[model samples]
Target: MGPTPSSSNDRSERRKRNAKTTIQSLEPDTLCMIFALLDFFDLVRCSAVCKYWNTIINKSKLLREFYAKQKQNSTEFSNKSTCSETSLKTYLEELAMEHHRVSLQEGLINIDQWKGHSVGFNQCRMKMGLILTGKGDKVMRLWSLESYKCVEEYAVPDTVPLVDFDFDESKIVGLVGTRICIWRRNGKRSIFPSNEGTFVKGLCMRYNDPEAVVGCEDGTARLFDMYSRKCSRIIRMRAGPVTCLCLSDDQLILSGSSLGSITVSGILSDQQVATLRSRITIGGIKTLCYNACSHLVFAGSTSGYTSCWDLRTMRSLWETRVSPNVVYSVQHLRSDKSTLVVGGIDGVLRTLDQNTGQVLASCVMEGNALSSSQNTYGATEKRKGRRLSEGTPIDSIPKSARPPITCLAVGMKKVVTAHNGRHIRLWKFNS
Candidate 1:
C-alpha cells in the first residue's frame, strides 16, 4: 500500500516549489510599503533575511529615499552631538575660571618688591589702581600700583603720627593724635575740632562718605560728620580703650577693646546690640573687619588668633591661631570670600579656608627666589650708589631678619603685603 519512491520524490519537489511563495516573492512596491512601515532597525534586520529581500530593499526607489533620509538624519544627529559637546566644553571652561584655585595649588608668586611708604606701613588699603598706606606718619602716601611710585602725599598739620588712615578718590581722612584730619585731592586740608582733646586720641579709624568713625582711647567710638564737621554721636563700649573698629553703611559700629571684649552697637541706637563672646581670650583684638554681604565680622587678636562671627545668629563661626605672635590683619576678597588671607608677626602670609579654618596655602620670605630678588635689588642699588634714606633702607635690611607682616591688601589676582620693615611684596596667583 506504500507509495513508490519516484512518486514520493515528485510530491516532495512540488511541496518545495509551493513553499517559495514568501516575502521575497512580493512585488517591489509591496516590499517597499512593508519596509516603510518598519523602523530603521527593523528594516535593517529584514535586509539580512535573504539575498532576494536584501536586493529589493537596497534597489527599490522608495526604500532608497528612506536610506537617503536616514543618512541625512544621521548627519544632523552628529552635528547636534558636536554642538552639544562644544557647548559643554565652553561651560566647563567658564566654571573653571569662576572657581579657580590658583592660589591654593600654586602657592603665590612674588612678582615685585618695592618700598610702599617713607616709614613702615601699619595700615594699607588698595582700590582704583592706587595703594594708600600709613604708619601713623606725618604724611600718608598714595602709590600707583602700576608705577610702584608715590604719586601723591597727604600731610597732616601736626607732627603726631596718624593712628589710622582711609582714602577714596576724592580725599584722604585720618586720625592724627586727638584730631581728625582730612586732605582733599585738590590740596585742601582740614582738621575737625581744630584742637586736641584727651578723650579723642583715636586708636583706629574708618571713614565712609559724609561720616567718619574713630575708636578712641577713652573706650568709645566717636562718629563725626565730614560734611558738618561735628561729632554726631558717641557709642561707648566701657570695656577698655578701643583698639580697633569697623563700620557698616547702615551705621553699625563694631569696636574692640584692649580688655579682650568686642561690642556691636549702632550709631543711631543708644544701647549695645551684642557683645561677641569668646570663651578663650587671646589677648585684645588688634584688627576688625565686617563683610556686609555675609553679615560676618572678622577679628584678629594680639595673640595671633583670627576669628569669625556671624552677625545674623550672633554666634561664633570659627577661630584659629594663624601665628605665634600678633595677627596684624585679616581680609578676604569681596568677589571671592571662601578663603581668608591672614598675615601676622610670623612674617608669613597664609590663606585659610573660610568654612573649616584649614590652612590652604602659605608664603614665607626666606625662599631661594626671594633671596635672589633681595640680592639682585641690593646689588643694583649699590651699583647706582643711590641709597634710599627714607624709611628703613631695603638694601640694608638683613635677609636673616624676616620682618613681620604689618598689613596686606587683596586684589583681583594679586596680594600686596607690607612688612614692619619698609619693604612691600606683590604676590601674583597663577591664572
Candidate 2:
C-alpha cells in the first residue's frame, strides 16, 4: 500500500500549487482588508509573498485608501471609550523612556536655572533659535540662547498684559489685550483689526489648515484664515470668557472657560462635540494643552490642579495636584510627551510626570519669600500714610514665586517660559 517516492514528491508539489492558486484567487479588496490590520513592516513582507499579493498591496492608491479608512476607524474607536489610567500611565512611561534614549543618542542637554526676574512670566515663544518673552509690560523681549544675552525688546502700544502668543513657522504672533499682532523676524509689527475685542485669552492654529483659532473674553471663538485675513467661522462656547483653547490633529477645537468647564467643538462642521467637567471646584480653567499623539487633553485649574482627559473616549483620565498656590500656566513638553511644566503663584516651577501625575522636580526661587515680606511691609506703611524706605521694584521679584508664568512654549530643541518680569528663560532637556 506504499506510494512511490516520485508520486509522493508530485503530490506535495500539487498541494503547494493549489494553496498558491487559492491565495491568488482572493479579491484584491479582501486581500487589502486583511493587509490593513498588519503594520508597515508586516505589510511589506506580505507584499513579497507573491506577485498577485504584491500587485495589490504595493499599489500606492490602494495603500492610501486602506490607511485612510484605518485611521478614521481608529479615531472613531478612540472617541468611543477612554483608556484606563493604569494603561495610560504605563504607555506614557514607556514613551518617556524612549524619548530619553533618543535624546541621549542625539547628545542633547537639559538645563534648569532660576534666571533672575522680578515679575511673573506670562507667555513665551521660540523660533529660529531665538526665545521671545511676553509679559504684563506689554513688551516682547528677545533672547539669544547661544549667546545667553537679552537681544532686543519690542513694545506694544497701550499694552494690556500679553496673555498668550504663538509662532508660526516664520513669524511670532502675540495676543495683546484683544488685538492680534504679527511680528516679523526683523522686529516689524502689524496689528490685525486692532479695535476689535476687549481681551484675547487663547490662540490655536490648525495643524494642517492655514487658519488660526482665537478665543476671547466675550465667550466666542473665531477662526481666522491667515491668507485672506478674514474670519471664516465663529464658534460659541457655553462657558463664556474662554480662558484657554487647543486644537487636535483632526481639527477638533477644545476650549476651557473661566467657569471651570471644557467644551469640545468640531472646526469644520461647527458642532458642539462634548463637554468635560472637573472634579474640584476651582476659580476657573487657566490652561489647556492637547497631545495629539496620545489622544489626551490636559486642563489646568486656577486652584493648582491639572486634570487629564482621554480625548478618544471623552472620559476623565486622571488628576494631580500641583502647587498650593494657583497654577497660572501649564505646558506639555514635546521632547518627552510624559513631562508637563507647571508654573504656580507659589513661585515654584515644577516638572510633572504626566503618566502618574507625580512631581519629578521642583525649583524654588530663593528671593520670593523676602520679596513678599518686603511687599507686606510696604503695604502696611502705605496704609499708615508713611513713606517707607525704598523697596524692590515689583519686577525684581525672584524666580521662585513662579508668578506670571502665563505662557510656556516648546521648540524642536528647547523650552521657553516667560514671566511678568519681562524675562524669558530657555531650557534644554537631555536624553
Candidate 3:
C-alpha cells in the first residue's frame, strides 16, 4: 500500500553502491592522478581502503618514480646511487629530529653590540672567526666573530648601497647597482659595461676557471676574467632580468630570471641549452644554488618556493614551498647529506633534506630591540617605498621582528643569517 516497499529497498541498495568510490572502476589515468596528490600519510590510508586500490598504487610507475626521487634525496647525488625503502624512511626520520634542539647559539656582529656599519642596509657572511659585511658609503668591513671587532675595513670610493657581494681568500666581489667591482689586497677594479643601462643583478665565481659569471638586468650573462678583469664571454637568454646564477660541478651555468625562467648553458658555448619554467609563477626565481653530487639545482622564488631540479633528466624531482612570502636566499653544501637551507623576507629559516622533500629544521630570525631601534632609523628609511608592497601587514607583526632576512652563509654546522635591519645572527646544529 505504501507505494511498493520492495521498490524503496531496491532504491536503498543502489544508493549504497553509489556512495562507495571504487578505484577499480575508475580509468587508469584518473586513478594515477589521484595517487599523485596523496602524500605519505594519505598513501597509507589509501592502501587500507581495499586490496584493489593498493595493487593499483604498487604497480603504477608513479610509485616507482616517487621512490627513485626519495632515494636520490637521501644519498649524495651520484650517477650510481641506490637506496632501499627502509633506508630512505630511516634517514628522513633522523633528519626530522636534527633541529629540535636549536637555540640562539651566539650573536655575532649584531646591531646591538657592534655599531661600525652606519646605514646597516647590507649583507653579512661568517667564515672561520671572521664576519664579512657590506654597508652604505660603498664600504665592506671584515670583523672578528669572537671579539665582535672590526679587524679590516675596505671601501670603494663612492659605491653606495651594495646590492650583493661575495668573496674568496684573495678577492671580494661587490655588485653595486649594476656594476661589478672587484676588491683585492692590491687594489679595487670596477668592470665597465658598453651598454649604459646594463645593470648586473648577480654573479657567481666559477670553480674550474678564473672567471665570474655575472647575470644582468638585460637578460644577458657575461663571464668576467678575473686575471684580465674583462668580460670574456656573453650568454644571452630570452627571459627577463637575470636575478641569480649558480655553477654546477661540470662547469655549467644555471641562471634564474625575474620572468620565471631558468636557463642552463655552458660558459664556453654560445647557446642556452635548456630552460625550466615555473607553471604557477611564484614571483619568479630570485636565487640559485647547486648540489654537485646530485647535479640538482636549488632555486628559490620570490613566492616562497624552494625547488630541486635534476639536470640529467631535466625534470623536477621534487619541489616545496617553505614560507608564505618571498625566499631571499638559498644554499646547499656538497656533502653526502643532502641539506638545502633557505631564508626569506618572512624571517622564516628552513633546512630541507633532499631525500624526502621534508623540512629538517625551521626557525625565525628574531630581531631584538636594538635591531628594531637601528632598522627603524636606517634600513626602513632607505627602502621606505617598497617595504609595504609585498602585501605583508607590518604594523600587526611589531617593528622589532619584521625585518626580512637579506642573506645567509653556512660553515662547519653553523648558519649565519643577515637581515635588512643590520642584524647578524648565528645558529649551530649538531650532527
Candidate 4:
C-alpha cells in the first residue's frame, strides 16, 4: 500500500486540470508568437485543443493575414455591410467552413466523374451551380453541377467549330468562326449575331460584361460591344495568331500570341503598353489569366512553362516548367491567390506556389473509376467511341491512348478536369 486508491485518482485528476491551465496561463502575446511559428494546418489542428486555443487562433490578425489574402476594406465587402465592417477572420471562417470542404495542400481524390461531351471537351467554365462546356463539334452544352445532367445545349454551324466560350448569370457568348455568337438565358431571342469583324477567324475570347474581346488568327484582338452588337476597335499584336486573351478592370488587355509573345495594351489608349517574353521561345502561349488583387498576370505556354508577371512594375516575377508538353490551363483560387493550379497534356494536375513558382503538389489521373461509394456520379449515356479505362487497371491501358487534360475549372474545394476523351473527372481534396 504505497498510496490509497482514492488519493492516487485525485492526484491524476489534479495533473490533468493543471495541464489545461498551463497553456491558458501564457500571455496572449506569447501564445500568438508561439502560434505564429506553426504552419497553416498545424495551427488548424492546434485550435481544436480547447476553447482557449480556438479563440486565439481565430482572433489573431497575423494568422488571418498569413492565410487569407482577401482585403477587408475592399469595395465588394465594404459596400455590402452598412453597419459593421467584415473582418478577415470572419471571411476566413466562412471560406473555411462553407467553401473549402477540402484542402489542396494535402492531396486530392478522384471522387466523381462522367462523360461531358460526345466529342472531346475543348473548353469549360463554371459559375454558381452550372457548368458550360464547348466541343469541336460546334456544340455548347450547359450541365447542372450537382446532377451532371445536360440542362441545355446550343449549337453553331457544323462547318465551324466552337473556338472559346464564357458565361455569366445572364447570357452565354462564344467565338463561332468569324462572328461573336450570343445566347440570352431568358430565351426571348437567341443567337444575337455581331457584325463580322475584319479578322479571318477567332481563336479565343474573354468577355468583360457588356464588352467582349476576341483574339483572332490574324494576330489581332477585336473589342466587341455585346449590347450594341458591333466591333469597337481592332488592336494589332503583330505577333503570330492571338491564342488567348485576358481582360482587366483597369482598362488593360493582355493578348498572348502563337509566336510566344504577350502584348499588353490599354483599352482607352488603343496602343501597346508592354510585351512579356518568356525564356522558352519555341512554345506559344496557350492560356492567360490576371489576378487583380496581387496585380499579377499568369500565362501558360504550349512549351510546358508557366510564367508570372507583375503588372505594377511590368516585369517577369517567376517562370517554371510545369509540364513536359503543353500547359493548356492555369487557374488560381479566388479567395487564396497563393496556390496556382495547372493542367495539360501530361494528364497530371499540379498545384504551384504563385509567389515563387515552386511546385507544391502533383496528382496524376489513371482513368480508372473509383468504387460507387467513393463516386456515385456516372455518365447517363454510354461513351460511343473509345472509353476511358473505366474499371481497368492503369498498367493495362496503353500510354498512347491516355487522354490529355484539355481544360479544367476550380470550384470551392473541388476541381473538374476535361480531357481529349469523352470523360471529365472531379477531384476533391482533404484537410
| TM-score, one value per model | 0.69, 0.61, 0.62, 0.72
Pairs that collide, model 3: 73-354, 73-355, 74-355, 77-293, 178-200
**Across residues 1-431, which tens digit of lDDT does each residue of candidate 4 receive?**
49999999999999988775666689988999999998765676577667888888768844555544345444444333443234545555555643352366563354565766667666778877788887765677788877777787777777766778898888888777677778777643244443444357888889989998988888888888877777878888666788889987799999988778889999888899998877656378899888887888998998899899898888888899877789999987665567778888876677778899987776654444434322233444211112222243434545543457788888766777778666666666655
Question: lDDT of model 4 at residue 128?
Answer: 72
**Number of clashes in model 4?**
0
Model 3, range 316-352, lDDT digits (tens) per residue? 7677887777888887543434667788887655667
Report the lDDT of model 3 for residue 335.
Answer: 49
Q: Report the Cα lDDT for candidate 3.
A: 0.62
Residue-level lDDT tens digits of model 2 in 130-167: 66665555566666655545566677777355655666
Model 1 ranges with Cα > 4 A deviation: 1-101, 104-108, 195-199, 366-401
TM-score of 2: 0.61
On lDDT, the leading prediction is 4
- Compare the candidates by TM-score and give the number of the best one: 4
Clashing pairs in 4: none
Q: Which of 3 and 4 is the better model by TM-score?
A: 4
- Candidate 3: segments with Cα more than 4 A from true spot: 1-116, 159-161, 186-209, 365-402
Candidate 4, TM-score vs. the true structure? Answer: 0.72
Question: What lDDT does each candidate get?
Answer: 0.70, 0.61, 0.62, 0.73
lDDT of 2 at 378: 28
RMSD of each: 25.9, 19.4, 23.4, 14.1
